[model samples]
Target: MANDTNEFWGKQAEPFRAFFDMQGEAMREMFGQMTPQGLSGAIPSATMAPGDMAEWAKVAGELQRMWLEFVQERAQKDMAGANPMDPAQWMLMTQSLAKQVPMAPLESAQKMAGDAMQMWQSVFTRFMAGGDPEDKPDLPRKDRRFADPAWQDHPAFALLHQTYLMLAEYFTKAARDVEGIAPDKRKQLEFATTMLVEAMSPDNFLLTNPVVMKRTIETKGQNLVRGMQHLINDLRRGQLTHTDSDAFTLGENLAATPGKVVHETPLYQLVQYSPSTEEVYETPLVIFPPWINRFYILDLTPKKSFIKWAVDQGITVFVVSWKSADASMKDVVWDDYIRSQIEAIDHVRDRLNVPSVHTIGYCVAGTTLAATLAVLARRDEADKVKSATFFTAQVDFEKSGELKTFIDDGQLEMIGKLSSEGYLDGRYLAATFNALRGKDLIWNYVVNNYLLGEDYPAFDLLHWNGDVTNLPAKWHRDYLRDLYRDNKLVVPDALSADGTPIDLTRIETPAYIQAGKEDHIAPAASVWRATRHFKGPVTFLLAGSGHIAGVVNPPAANKYQYWTGDSSAASLKEYVEGADEHPGSWWPHWLDWLESHGAKKVPAKGKRKPGGKGDKVIEDAPGRYVKTR
Candidate 1:
């Protein structure tokens, strides 16, 4: 009976051994087909290229190493009975391996043929483009090491490249298997690891191929040109940054100085139209800024600062410099921010004796200002504010784009975990933003400075981007959950800071909404939606450039083109109609609008000194907190 059972088992093993042999044969055949001519579907009777021979040797060496490792790992697994492939797993693995088995040959052939073509193309282009022989044109800009001229004639380069190509093919095949495996059971990782090890074989780096070298040469050449262009562009921006300082600093200096006379209104005081002024309108202006960033982006260094321009034009400038949330104020929320704006307006009213205030809200601060207006409207205190300005602020979230990707459930959970500590550290906030646009700020610097051997200059915007601010945990949670993720701001019956559901329609103030044509964060369409909710007249201005550049517009740097004229009341539709408009800054247009309605008088030298309002100077203007991290 025992002899009969052994015979039965041996017979079963015969078929399994035969199947394994066939699979191995298929793999060998695939590897053999990696010759350039074989891959190109043509047979070459001529001798093998010396470079191709070198690549084959390198591949053989790496394959031998991988085989040893695989055998050792398999032996360990067999001993431990830890084979992930039990009967069911074995069947699945067999099927998966069967599909991937041909991949190595396919990849080998592809690389061999591709390299041959690349070599021929490089030799042809080098002569045709007609550059100095010494200054060979670079091809692929990314990999500079591949640009060695010796690669064209070196036999080892061709061989190693071809080998690596085959390794890459196998690696890709294995990576696909890994991706297919259940996340819990990463059986494919072992295969992927083997593929990566083989692809990065030391022999692969021994000699660079002509194809790779030519690509490098071309890429390096293009990078050289691009670097020059970037330098020129940076220099121009530097000049603009300098010139912008002159424009904004002049205005800020005047405001900061004791008695440097400018317009009829005192530099720092809100200019309310009295019977004494040329023109009088009921609308008063109050400016709101988030404590997260420096207020100067709205009022950057002189000709650039919109605040200075607005003040000079006799617009009532009640700017709110939000006190940064300190350790003691960890529990501050959306309600607190809104209340601060309300208090600011009341302070301006009590101090300047203005009956109604026009509110200008900047970025996130715009949300609070809008909320304040809604609160006022809810209580029938709309009389307090006559007009409102929203600069790159959103109440609607339908088209929030990448920002939406950021506030998903996982992010909320992470934020919740982080906020368990006191404050949401500001540096983390800055880092998040930096990563969002890392290609330009971080990677670009690495490529230019490290790879291209160039120096990166000090960029003020980059500097500012690095400066981060923390949000109070409660404030961030509420802001994200209530307003951003939930679309509470636009909903008429949504729960708000007050017990009653907030209604934006109650906001009857005239609105001046300005957005950038290329603004990514708050698309003009989102900003335009506010007009639909507000029961008031709306003037939407689409300026050129991105969020920051659009808002901190300088008249001197008329780099941006704007859309204007009697257009439709709709935001996006008007923008579409106003495309291809002439070049000019949005500042002048806003200035014209304000000047037409602002209080008018001769430049005044009224000796009212801004002595910090007799309050102790606890922190500097723009503040230390905003500049840190």
Candidate 2:
């Protein structure tokens, strides 16, 4: 090689290069010492190894032949191009081939080693820190975290745990691999290598890297500091403007103007309905939103929120705004939720003077709706619910996606153990759900806001995620035992909300079920299985994204792809009828159906304009509850 100054490598690379050269010298010295000491024949039976050596030689020859062939093929490609022998061009070819090699396995191996060392250390640390798993406190009473059916059988979590175990094993094996290495050379080669490997490990680097962890602490401190700054900003702005009935009107447009609130209804003003307004539609719409999130996601912003779309399409909507559970709501159960929904429906009935209503149940709310539907059907009150729409809802448990991994006999029993307390805590459920998406959701937060000192806005979506609600223990236990463990929702004679056999066939209302193609909670196939149980006209729509994104999806963006089967043309089986085509977002198709069912404009009953006598309005569009946690 021509003598050249090390211009390509910076001063930082020198220490690494020097260390590498030292390792080679150490290896040579180690071999020299062993050769004369007669310890070099340490490998199993050198004399008997001749036959094995011959086989190895044969394998080496074949590998060389294959490698030569590969080089020749590449050489031909290079020769075909102009300026074939240019050294720089050849370097590019070499680099391209080098890039194709899979380095993740090597990276993973190092990670395994580091994780093993940490786990070994943790045994001692846990003892000192009093963090032993056995010392963990018993499940709390009134903890809603235990009640979520997803807890019993979450698949993503199971995968993460399995990955963790494999990493541990890999680490232990690496330590063994280096054990046979000589001690004198160990410092030169193995020690530094171990340190470097440990430094880059997922556990060490991600879980507890001093540099990264310090940055995280700094970022969190900065966030609090910034929060204080925002409070100051608010105070300064408050001086310029005035507070109008607990609502602060911004003097400066510091936040993005018209920052859209998605997947919820506007509740800026207290909702008011006059009983004197005569009904135009034959049936009204009563939407049930999950207590886990704010009710308004369905009516988020003007054009995008499902509630807005439905209202614009001329459907009379009444959404229940759930109050955060306190000691007063401690005794609530599945029956209570059912009663609340019924009471809301009654309110709509009294307001519009309508006979029956169309009930749309979303996420976990759908399960509650199914129970109510069954109760209504048994009492021959089917006239109460004109039709039902389930958005990303699961009635069948067999193929319920990753959420199932958290459920099993053991987990359910554990939940039952926890429920002796009054309510299921929502904060715990939020933490676990956040854990499920640790790499993307949790780690992303750590790196972005914590490590990078970035500021995320007080967006409505984030706010809703922050605002969590508790679940009653009795309700949650039955939910898990019936829905997840036993797959009771679809079975006619399966255990019911009240222990009476739930027969979904009796819930014969026209049903429209929608699920996302990428939904991790409830798969499309699981939603499609509703056809087998419900005798009603079942319409299955497969949307494009995940649970939340798919439902909040709008037409103006026009990003998603979805499919829907004929509601009455035939059963879900016969409707496909060899059709192998894909359709776009279910939003427009749903809008069309809603328009067909929607009543044309009846005269504005009360007044042409607001008398300001009705419940106060928040803003023209997006509401207050969504903006404020």
lDDT (10s digit) by residue, model 1, range 1-629: 12422232233233234423443443343234433333222212244476654544443444344445544765775633312212232233223323222111123445545755675565556545655756755432223333444543344553344344444444444434433334322323333233223323322221122442243244432333333334333333321111122232322342231111112111022222112233333344667766566554555544555665665554534455444444556778777777667766776566545576667888788877788888888877878876677888887776664455345454566566656654676554554454345444434443443224244454445444434456777888777787777888888867576554577888877777887778877777777677677787777778888788887767777676877643345457765665557687777776566555444433221211222245222332433333333
Worst 10 residues of 1 by lDDT: 258-267
| Model 2: per-residue Cα lDDT over 549-609, one tens digit each | 8888877667777765564444445545633435445677775555465545464343211
Q: Which of the numbered candidates is closest to the native, going by highest TM-score?
A: 1
Q: Model 1 compared with the native: what TM-score?
A: 0.59
C-alpha TM-score for every candidate: 0.59, 0.56
lDDT of 1: 0.51
lDDT of 2: 0.50
- The runs of at least 3 residues in candidate 2 whose Cα sits more than 4 Å from the true structure, single-residue gaps closed, are 1-282, 409-421, 496-501, 566-584, 597-601, 607-629
For model 1, state the Cα shift of residue 450 in Å: 6.0
